[model samples]
Structures are given as structure tokens and as C-alpha cells.
Target: MIRIFKQLLMTTLSIGLLASIVGAQGQQTVEAASDSTQATIRVDKVDNLSSDFIMGADTSTMISEENSGVKYYDFDGKQSDLLTILNNNGVNYVRVRVWNNPYNEKGQGYGAGNADLINAIKIGQRATKLGMKVLIDFHYSDFWVDPGRQVPPKAWQNDTVDQKAQAIYDFTSNSLKTLRDAGVDVGMVQVGNETTTSGICGVTGNDEYKLFAKGTQAVRDVDKNILIALHFTNPDKTTTMLNYAKGMAKNKIDYDVFATSYYPYWHGSLDNLTYVLKTIANTYDKKVMVAETSYPYTLDDTDGETNVVKTTDDIKPAGYPATAQGQAHALRDVINAVANVGPKALGVFYWEPAWTTVGGTDRAANLPIWEKYGSGWASSAVIGYDPTVTTSTYGGSQWDNQALFDAKGHALQSLHTFKAVYTGVNEQLPDPMLSDDEATIASLLKNPSFEETKMSDYQLTGSIKLAQDTPKTGKNALNFYGDTDYSADASQTITLDAGTYTFSPSIQGGDTNASSDLAIYATINGQTKSVKVAPLTGWKKWLKPELTFSIAKQASVKLGIKIKSNAKSWGTTDDWILTKIANSDTDQSGSSSSQASKTSEQSASSESDTLASSMVSTKSTKNDVSSSKRDKTLPRTGEKVMIGFGLVGIVMLASVCVIYFKHQAS
Candidate 1:
């Protein structure tokens, strides 16, 4: 009887084990399935932290929460303006951008862009006055922030890296203090608009870490405890993002939270955000926030102009209105999507919610930062029309339409939806991830393009034969004949060793209209010089530019050539020349005989000069290919080559002369 009972128990145990396996597999399959749908999202287990983010909504719904409900007294309108309702419901923060020097030299203040310190102060003051937490966003530039086109502010040019970093730090700390001084309680301060990704400060291809570290350090030094968020534009590559964070941490840099800018129009739907947030938060063990986010309310252009029109197709969901009601719904939905990510999800900041219609006040209109493609403007401001009574021929009040409150500052019916979203009590919507089964959402968090492939050393050779264009590589490479134009093909490396060399692409004055001239230039030590080449025809082996430049004994240099066409139009011929030669011999250009006789004398003199002079340019600076060391002396705009000699060749020849004199004494 005991043996029989044991057999039955074994059978029961086997069935139970099989059921557990099947259940686990089913859950995985369900998640995989949701992956196939656009709205389906997935969550990765990074931490056991509960993700209970506030899903506050922003409502630009025109006039009162129940504006539509009260139609002919059909229903009572909801109380409050959309934004206020969201704030009351649970929204924790609001972000706004401030532009610097938006006014032209004329001082005739441009529109809302002049959110100079004074303007920013007012906005912060108003937001705090309403008891809402304000976030100060420094655009770094007077415009937008993104991967492409993050030109530093114009005035900051010529400043050293330290100077620039300090400037940013001062601007941030001071601005934050200013807001606080004005009785405006600023909860967060974004050091730079969006630098969470790779291109933070050190000028992309250069010492990115060094430069960014300085700024990041500077900001922290100002207020160690303030929540410092590193904002990134892409969420897909958690590894890449983590790599950057690790690099910073290795250097002992500290930041409180990680933030990202995600727009479904560009990033994708709900699933993408959830995966990015959870993965990055768990990986880095830091808080996460959607620092800057937005969506168009309608497909219609308020001004009735097709060019300025916003389209749902530009994003998705095809029929979203350009109307107030449409915008309010879209706003509410996005907030809910972010909140569902869980615990580390602090909240979302609606960018420029009060960007109202003020004449000449469009940020993207006059500011190149906001302009996309053509000049018509890609106005992303929420407030669609003007609240002020002032009128303009350009439909000045267009932006005021997106404002949460009506023209009279009265609450709109859409406010009810915003409040519902924030309270988190509306409904426990089914997990967007639970419905997903496919894992495609993983793609959204992919890394930005990385050149993981190793590079190989190789030589690229070609010539600017008489009429053909020869591309120039290094600043020291020579141009042959009378050709001066050269294009740098995508991949080629020209290396220069310490020595004196001459390079010049010349041209014979043919048709008086065809008076073309060629000049070669070189950057050595820390200076550049150019020299005229004796004009010659194709491969005129006879004309050797008498170039004699002394490259510091252990220094490297780059070569370039400037082509001149005295014709009605410059560069009409479209041809260039390239040549490279390394001269390690200390001999003068006079040849072998000269070298043997003067070697010793030249050596002694060079020793003297080297001892007396501090390491000139190339002063132990690393020559990383990605670096951009602006020769402060390099003409801001390309300087016109005179006769045929440019600054580069002249400097090279002068150095050669100095070395020649030393050779004579030896």
C-alpha cells in the first residue's frame, strides 16, 4: 500500500513541474507577440523598484475643461484650464527654454525668443507663482539642441575649453540663482539642452570626455546636491549610453539622473520609451526622466497656410487635429505612456508650454536654431495663438491657440482629461507590454552608429593632371603643376614628419581672363604660411617651387594648396594637385653638396633655437584625427591668397631661410 501511494505522488509532482515550465514559456510568448504591434511595449527586469510614475497631462484645450460638454447647455464643462488640471492631478514638473542675445545688433527685440534672462525670470516667476515647479533649460546655443548642428554660441568662439566650460557653468548656476532670488523656486536646471549622448562638449571628434567632464564638473561644483540630469536624445543603445556613463564615472564624475528626449514621431510608440527607461535605469542604477518631449496637437495650420501646416502623417494616428481638442488628447496619452514605465521614471517636462503668440515672438521663426529645411519655420510651441490684444498682419496671435488657458485666462474643459491622467486613479490600463509578444521594441534602444571596425594603414595616390582635379589630403601635401584645387576624398591619411619641404600647384597666364595662379600652404609649429609656385603646364618637371621651411625637429605638419582662377568666377577650372615628400636631412635646398658641408653647423644652431624657444605650436598636443584645434591665427573665413602666396607657404619658406643660414655656419 505504501509503494502504491509513492507512485501516485511521483506522477503528481511531474505534472506540477510541467505546468510551471509551460506557464513561464507562455508569458515569454505573450511578450514576444506584443512586440509585433506598434502600441505593445516590453519591460526588462533591471531593478525590483516599483515604477509608479505620475502620468500628468498637459491640456492646451481651449477654454474650460467642459468647453465641448457645455455645448448649448448640453453638458456642464469641466473646471480648470488643461495645464492646471494636469498640475493638480500629479504632474511634478514643467520645463522652459531661454535664448541668449536673440535680439539683432539693432536691439529691436525679436519675438518671444528674447527670453533673455529677464524674460526667463518672468516665466519662472509666473510658474512658481502658480505653485508649479519650474525647470530652466539652457539651449547653449540661442536655438535648438540635437546631434546635428550644435554650434556653440557665437560669442564663445576664441575662448579656451576652460573658458567655455566655465561660461556654461556660470550661466547655469547664475540663472538658477537668479530665478530663486526672484522668488521663483526652480526645481531643476539643465546645464545644457540635450547632451545625454556622445556629442557633449569636447567637439565631437576630439577630446569629448575632457571637455564634457569640465562642464559637468563645473555644474556640479556649483550645487552638488541639485538633481543633475544627463539628457540623451536616443534611448535605444543602452550599452552605448552606459559606456558614456562609465567613462564619466571612471573619471570620478557624478550625475544624479539620466534623462532622454523622445518623440514618437522620431523615436516610435509607447514600447520604445518603456524599454529604454527601464534598461538604462537598471544598468546605471540611476533615476530616469524624459527631460524634453512634445507632440503636435493638430494637423491643421492655425494660420491657414499649407506650408506651416502640421500633419498627423508627419507622425502617425493620421487624423490628430490641428485643433485644441486634438492636441489635449494627444498630450494626455503621451503622459500616460511615460508613467507606465515604473519607479525610476520621475516624470516628463512639456517643452515651451507657454510659447504663446507674441508678435515677432516665434523662437524658430527668426532664430536659425528653430528653422527646419526652409524659412517658413517649424514652430513647435504649444501655445498656438496670442493672448495679448496686440494685432499684426502675420496673424500674430497664431501661437496663442496652443495655450492651456483661453484668451481670458479661463480654464478649458480639456483640463479634466489632464487631471484624470495625473491622479493615476482613472484606470489600471492593461500593461502595454503584457500584450506584446515580439521583441522588436528592443531595436528602439539601439546605439547610435559606431565605427567598430578597425582601420588599416594604406596609401591613396592620384594626381590633378592638367585639367583633372587632384584632391589634397594633409595641409602639407604639395599640389603639382599650376593646379591648386584639391578635394579630400572620404578616406585618406596624409602624414608629415619633421622636415622642410615646398609644394605649389601653378598655372600659366593664358587668356588674360584665364590668369590662374596656384599656391601651396603648410601648418607647422603653430603657424601657417603660403608661397607662390612658378606657373607650369601639366607635370612641368622643370618648375620646382623653391620652398625651404624648417619643421621643428620632432614635429609633424599638414599641407594644403589654394587654387586661384583670375577668371570671372573663381574655381571655374575645378582641378587640383597632390604630392608628398619627407625631407629629414638638415641640408639646405641647394642639394647633396650643401647638406654634407652644413650638417654640423645646422645642428648646433637648431639646438640653440630649440633651447631658447618654448615648444611652439604642436606643443606636446596630441594629434588625434578627430580633434579640431582652431589656429586662432587661421583666418576666420578663408583668407584670399595674394598673387599666388598664401600665409601657409610664406611661413614655410621663412623657416627654410632660417635653417639655410644655420647650415652655412656649420
Candidate 2:
């Protein structure tokens, strides 16, 4: 009884200790020391300053009272539409994309999307009227810049790479000049749209630094103060993009900022988006933004022509309530995520926030304006239309009501929430620690070059198997958490953002029959290191076992984990577990980059799985004895102690029950 009571006391102490540890992990807000002499800015001044800095919206659907109920103007008639509202609210800038001519040869107008000097002037006029800065987006081509297409303007159709370069220069210079003359205050300009395709007429854009330099330089020449941005589609493709940017920089292409389009439905998830932004920002010393991002309010809408699509394979199901209210929540979530990125995260620009309604002629295929002119010129309308009138496939409007303001122009409640909440750039969050192995694996998984990956923040629980003869070749071959694992022994690689991390395993040894030895390893920059573990013996309760290590912030490195067994002379790994935790690389570490050295000649032992029982084998020996026997003998001091206390209480209750029974019988 004494021994049992002692055991109970120890178990209670252990649990209490764990609870204390967890409590210590929480962050505490500290009060600043009082300093009455410090200069204090007026509240009004701070409000004005904040309004001038925060700009996060897309007004493609922005309309004036003269055209439709949806007006960029506010309730106060004194203020002009969007610009004034932006100036008053925290929107200091706006981005406007321009397309070449957007007109048919017949001289008919192609509408607002046209980069014609006339429309540019009009848009510029509106911007100036609102006292907002404008960003001109030159698609270069007469149409859109997309992954599947990059149609050069008619003028440059037959031009050589050199001619194309000149055309780009001439186009940029002329466009900027026209906007400048119109009294528009230019803030930034995008040289091109998402360009990840092959070159124009055989000139490769993937690494065509010379061509990129020419185009960017042309824009820079127009106005040195205007921030020049290089845009791409995916954030995770940092290395590929960095290589291209480095090439451009090498050739003297000067641009002010770096940007990428990170639509999660098209990219992956917020985590992936964060990984991409943090990595790129840390790699290149440039401010960045999530140039375009959006989430669907519902999956019910058919993805006929809208940017949001309904696909079964999204990382997560529609996040909103699948209703307008849900969409607001989703949008809020996205905004918060972007805000969480902090200062390095300049801000977010919700793509086409005003693309609420589809217009009548927007998607008329084979029409001169859309097919021949390549501008969707005849189509592209921001208002809803009678579906009965469409004789063609792309005639309905899908974006009419998704605006911050309703179709009737009343601002949504979320707008006020947004206006009040978004104070400044989100401060970068601290990095969590990771074990050396976890860091290496995360780094390898994040690198886009490694190919297939599925490392989502999604919680997963399951058993995995690797081949004995060739451990990585089995049915459930272990893979990098980020990449897909196909066969046994197949290696995967990934590049990670800078941070400290903790690597941990989910699968315990008790569940597997084979005596496996799991090895975790990391190679930062280039240096390689390894950590070893013994296999589990059987079914076990979950525990938070972690490995902590520090890695350079934003360092590009390779990480890996392999499993093997000792008895079979043939390795067999039935279940494997691995993960990472990252430390805040910045603030804690200096800016200098580091190099890694590979370990000296070390031959891996042969694969073997001698134990045949489905039960966990004896490999996890704590040196004193095998884990299985020890587990049974010790009763896991903690678990035993609890059991003892529980039994004592149960016995006491039973004695009470007996006394009651005897009294009743008497």
C-alpha cells in the first residue's frame, strides 16, 4: 500500500511538472516604463498617417453613381468616390492593369481594359480626383499574361528578341509618359503578368535575363521614383524565381520591389503562402506583397468563367460558411493571415474585390474583340446581365455582387471591421524551434525543385512501411513530409524559409513488428548532420517528444530521414514519423549567409528486419533492458501512480456500498 501511495505521489508530481512547463510557454505582455517627457503625436495625425499607408483592395468592379448604383463615392457628397474613401480609409495606392489597344481593326472601342491613352487618362483622372496614388500594370501583350498564353502585341509579332526589347522600352516609356501627362501620381508599375512559360517566339522567359532587363529598364526610365515590380504566380517557387531575379539583377536590371500572385486555391494554403513570402523576402532584400489573393464564398457556383473555381482537390474545403456571411469570415481570415506576416508583408491586395458582377459581352468566344483582338475586348463587363440574352457560352456575369459594397452600393459591415482593424503592417511572428532532423526535412520539403509534396498543416495519423531489401521501396515508402513518397529508398528534397525548428516523429515503435532504426538528418546550405532513434515496441499513448535545433534564417538547405533494421540483414520499416519546428531567424541571427559541409565518409549499415512478430520488437532497449519488458515492469511510473490512486478511491467506495447494504438488511 505504501509503495502504491508513493507511486501515486510521483505520478501526480510528474503531471504537475508538465502542466508548469506548458504554462511557462505562454507569452506575457509587458507594460512600457512611463516617460512623460516623450513627444506624443496627436490622435488625428496618427489617423491621417495610417490612412496614407494601408492600401489593400481591388476596385475592378468599382463604379460611379453615374453608371450604376455601385459608386466608388461615399455617403458624404463632399468626397469623390474610391480615391477619397481610400485616402480617408487606409488605402493610399491603387493598381490598374492595362492591355494593348483592346480594339478591333474596325476602330470600335474595346472598353475599359484598353491601354489606350484615352482610358488611361480617364482612370488617372479618377485616381487624382480621389487623391490616391496609381500603379500602372502593362501586360505588354495586346491581352492578358497567363500560364497558358503570352500573345505579343501585333506590333511585336514578327519582331526579334531585340525588337521585342525595344518595343517593351517604347511601350513602357510611352505609357508612363501618357499617364504622367494626365496628372496621375504614379506609385508603382508591374512590367508583366504571371510569366512562367517559354519565351516569345523562342526567346525563353524562364531565364531570359537580358529580355527582362530591357523591359524593366524601360519602365524605370519613365520615372525613377515609381516603384517597379516583377510579378510571378507561385510564392513557393522561390529558387526558380530567385534565379531569374538574380540573373536580371546581375545584368543591371533595377526594380524597386518584388511581388508574387498567391491565390491559395491556385497556390496551396496560407502556410504555403507564408512559407513563400517569408523565404523570398529573406532571400532577396526587397519588400513584398500578396499582389492577388481570394477565397470563394461558396463552392456551389459553377466555375465557368470566374477566377475562383470549384475543384475537389483544394487543400481545404471552402473556408467560409458557403454563404455570403461565410465569405466575409473567409475574407477576414485571409486579411488576418496577411496581416500576420507583419512588416515584411507590405500588405495584401484582394484581387478584383469589385469584380462582383459579370457583364454582357465578357466571354463571347471567337468574337473579334475576344478572339481576334485578344483582349476579351468585346466581353469584360462589370455589371450583371439577363442570362436569357446570351447566345454564346460566356455571356453571364458572375462577379457582380461579390464587392465590398453591395450591388446597390451600400458598404458591407466587414468593411468597417477592416477599416478599424488594419492598423499597420503585421509584425513577423516568432519562429518555433525544431530538431536538426526536422529542420532538414522541412527545408527539403519546402523546396519546389523537389517535385511532389503534401506537407500541409493538416493533422494526419497512420502507419507507413518501407522495404527491407531497399527500405524506401515498399508499399508505404516514407517520403519527405512535403513531397509524395512512392517507393522505398526514394529520396526527396525541399527548400525552407529561415527559422529555428523542432523535428518530431508521430509513429511510435510499439506498433511495428520489425526492429527499425530511424535516422533523421539535415544539410544546411551544404553541411550534413544526422540523429538516430530506435523503433517502437507496441501500441502506446500519444506523447509530445521533440527535437530542438537552430538553423539559419531563410537558409536554403536539404533535409532527410531514413529507416532500417538490425536483425534481418534486410531493412524493413513499417511505420515512420518526422516533423520540424523553426526558430525566429531574424532578430536573433545576423544577416550574413552560411555554407554547409558534407559529413566525412560514413557507410550505412545493411537493411535488416529480424523480428517477425506483429508486436513491437525489442530494438527500443533503454540500455538497461528492452522497452517492452521495461514498460510492463515499470508500468510507466506515471501511469502506474495514477492507476494506484484510482484503485484506492474505488476500493473506498466499495466499502461504503457494503456498509449501506448491511444496514439496510438489518
Candidate 3:
């Protein structure tokens, strides 16, 4: 049942994304370019950019990409070095975001360009050779950092605030010295990336600004001429942005430039973007610039990893179409927006624009590459540092379609926007009519079917993964279990209004002879309810058992599949759903609907025992399974298991046993 609401609450955005493997997948996704010529997106230049206006692109991952054998081509399709291509397109600055350590204790690179000091050195050296300046963005964390997170490096986890400030100064000073030694033109240094809410080192508000002051002091000591920049994002919140700007002054955080990340998608309108920056510039007498901005040329997944902007609705926030020309217009307009803020506007940096497609349209084929080559946004190795790296959010780039280069590694028309902003693109371009899938559903839960195989929404445990052995319907199913006795589940939490809902989980795997138990469980408030599935007799066979429950008010509910199995017990589960069938103001125990739901659950359990017993009897007749009582079993999602031969064996003489013996053929 497809339930279309005003919006999808269950899936996407940073939340919408942690899950999605469908709506955009395999094959050439965007429509072929049109033969008829159309006018290229033109920009209304305002002072355009003086010789000092920064045209920057975050090519932080280009090293890993080039190492992976990707080649960069100019707009004309001629092979060229990346820096040279950018230079030809009027790009004068290269922004490189560096992490303290994006690796695990095993020393494996945690992908996402493995943004270590070494890569920064390599990129700085290369970009400087072409006369382009480098902006060294220090995230001050082992992994990615933004407004939501500010984990201090492990080495300084236990340090005091004063100690952290000193450590920040020393680290920044040493890193700048290293870059200078490498014959690189280090033009600017960013204290932190998007340090608005929680700035750095697990600190909040004023504490965050203090850390930035230490970093700024180090930059000033290293090179007075080098711009000391403080970066923040979200200009949409005028009051917040203004107060943050004022907070910088109140805290006396000395910095030369104030940078904001202005992605047209999530960040607010261009006018607001200008107003926020202009206020800071005029008030503080500090230079301002856009630290990051990007727009997708298409809503397709070029590398099988889901694209962040995978739907038409995504660009609606920015009012831009998903096309190469549309991408150019968005970028060009941003450049003009910053330039219009007077000469104090330093420039705009297109964040990771060159992070093009590195893998094919199959995540299975791409996951290993992501783990090894530092390609994906995050890797399994980073799970050590960032607890958020799950089976779904760990691998592959969600920003590929938004890259300046096409999936084929050729520069898109958007790349020329840097130069075209001032000179104006005179050529008539192709329409390149492109469209995306419903991409996102307004479902109560945010997730995908196995055919998508991305496993976008669920947090899986143990041996569970989307297996392609034999799908329940499409190309894959949720599979779990191994030779050893283990408990596994794929769970996702959802928020819903108070009402009665039915949860039905489809399952398959093994035969009636299997000793494993596959059940669907839902956790509402503090209580958990579950229903076991019937025995599956065929590899393609699937059984769904319904469990209904009620909540009195708006509450968070956790839903997922639970497996408790003996040794060598394995199973596949798929298409689990929770549907709200009614709305009543009655209590769960008093409502008729609740009673019916409980009765349905009991009926389903009775059927499971009857069918599972018959399958077991057939297997016993063939001498395929042992008659002795199995040892361990996982009953609920997090319930303790019975290891030894508990009283459960003696309790097996129920109707299930009676049915089993009657069906037995001696």
C-alpha cells in the first residue's frame, strides 16, 4: 500500500539519505543531450570579480580519484591535468579539507579522500605549481565535522579546554609549517568547517569560538599575509547567523575572513545568503566568502551510491532544474551574489565538485573500492571514530551527480561557470532534458526494497545484509545467519501519531526442517511486541505474519526483523511494513481494534507452530535433522537467549508436537 502524505517523514535528507538504493539506479540515468542548440545559462554579473575574487573548487579527493585511474578532461574533451583544467576555466583557488586522521587503529584509510595531512601536502604542492592558491580547511576532527558533530581527535579526547586550545595552536602551527616547506602557496587557512552550532573539540557555543581563536592565533603566527578564515553555514537563519557573527566579536575571535557554506538546496535563498554575509562584512570589517556550494546536474546515481539530490523536489528548495545548464546558473548566480557584496567578498568554493563517479552503477561492485581507495564519503573503518557510520551510510559517494565532472570523467558545462560568470557563455547548448524517479516516497518509514540493494534506511546487526542469492520478488532480500548460533536484525525507528497499526514482515529461507525462528518485532514506548512467521518450504517462498499494536500518543516506535536460530540456521526476510489501520481515543487494552490485533497475532503464531512442525516431521522422516533438543535460541530483538537445555524442550509437547507426530510417516 503506497501512502502518499504531504512529505516523507520516514526517509531522507541527512535522514532521507542514511537510506535509499532505488528510484535512481543502473544504466545511463539522464536523458541523452538534445541535438537542437539552446542558449547556455547566462549570468548577470555584478562587479563580477576583481583580480582578487576567489574562484575555488574543493578538489580534496582528486588525489584518491587520480590514484583510482580517473582522468580529467577539459570542456573540449582534451586530456589535461586537473589543476590546469581548472586554471583554463579561470579557477584560481583550490580548497583542501584535511582531517587529523580518517583512519582506524588498523591504519586503514577511511575513504572520503582519506583527508590526512599527507594528501593536503600533495595537493598543495601540485596546485601551487600552477600559481593557484590553496585554502587548508582543518576540520579539527578525525572524521567529518559539521554543525551536528565536533568530536575532538582521539589524542586530545581527555584534554582540558585550556589543553585543547594549546594543542590546537601547536597542531595548526606545525601543519602550516609543513605546507610552507612543501613549496606550496598557502594563501588561506580555515579554522573549522561549518562551526556554527558546536564549533570544535566537543564544545558548544562560546567554547567553540575559543577553539577557533587558538587556531587563528596559530595561522597569524605562521604567516601574517595568509588569510585567517572562520567558516560557518546556514545563512537562512538570519537571527542565528547575525548572533553568531556578533558572538565572534563578543568573544574577540580574531579572524580575517568569515566564510559561509551556501548550498542552494538546503541553505536558504540567494538574497538571504547575501544579507547574512553583507551584515558580517559591514559590521566586523572582515572579508566574507562562500566556503561551500553545489547543485546536481542530474538526479541519477552515477556510481550506484545514492545521490543527495535524487529528486526534482530536492532542487525545488533552490528553484533550479536538474540539468547541466541549471547547475551552471546556480553556481554563476552564487559567484555574483558574493561579488555583489563589494570587494570584501573573497570568493566561493564549490565543495567537492570534482568528486566524480569512481564506480559502476552497482554498490556491491563499488563497496570494496570505497573501502580501499578513499572514494566514498565515509568507510567502514571510520566506524571506530564516527558511531554514525552504519551499513547504509558507510560506503559510496552521495554527491556524485552534483560533481562538476560527469560520470564519464568529462567536465560538464557547469565547470565553465567559473569563467562564464564574467565572460558569459555564448554557445548554444543542448537541452539535455533530464528527469528522476519518485526517488522518495511519502511513506511512514524511510527505506527501500532489495532491488535497490543500497539498504539506505536500516541499521543492520550481525550477519545481515541484502543478499542476492534468490530474491523474494526483486533482485535481493534481507539475509542473515551463519553456521554459528547468532542473533541478527535490521531495524529502523519511526515517529507517528497515536493510533493502531499492523506490522507484517515477509520472510523466506531454509525449509520446514530449519530450526531457526524468524519473527517481526515492534517496540513502542517501553514495551515490545512480536509475531513469528510460518515455515518457508521453498527458496522463493515468503510468509508474512501480522502483529498489531497501539500507542496512546505521539511516540517513537522501533520496528525490525528478529532472528533466533540454532546452529546452521539461516533465513531471508524482506518487505517489512507497519500500516496504521485506525485512529481511536481508547486505551490499547480497552479498544476493540486492539483486541482484534492481538487475536490476529495469536492466530499467526498458531499457524507458525503448525506449519513449522509439519516441515520438521518431513525432515525427520528423511533423517535430515537431529531429534535432540537444540541448545540456544534468540527469541526477541534484544532478549537474552537460553544457552543450556532449559525447560523449553520439555514444553514442546503442545499442539505443534501432536500435529508433527500425526503427519509423520514411519
> What is the per-residue lDDT of model 1 for residues 55-145, given as tens digits with 9 covering 90 to 100?
3222221111122121111012344444344455445555656555544444533343444567667655655666776666666654444
Residues 369-422, model 3: lDDT tens digits: 878888888888888678768766787888988988888788776776776666
Using Cα atoms with residue i matched to residue i, what is each candidate's TM-score against the true structure? 0.45, 0.50, 0.61
> What ranges in model 2 sit over 4 Å off?
1-54, 60-89, 109-112, 198-203, 238-242, 298-307, 310-318, 323-343, 358-393, 396-398, 423-666
Candidate 2 per-residue C-alpha lDDT over 623-644 given as tens digits, one digit per residue, 9 for 90 to 100: 2122322321211224344445
- Regions more than 4 Å wrong, model 3: 1-44, 426-666
What lDDT does the true structure give each of the candidates? Answer: 0.42, 0.45, 0.72
Q: Highest TM-score, which number?
A: 3
Q: How many residue pairs of model 2 clash at the backbone?
A: 68
The best candidate by lDDT is 3
> Of the candidates numbered 1 and 2, which has the greater lDDT value?
2
lDDT of 2 at 398: 47
Better of 2 and 3 by TM-score: 3
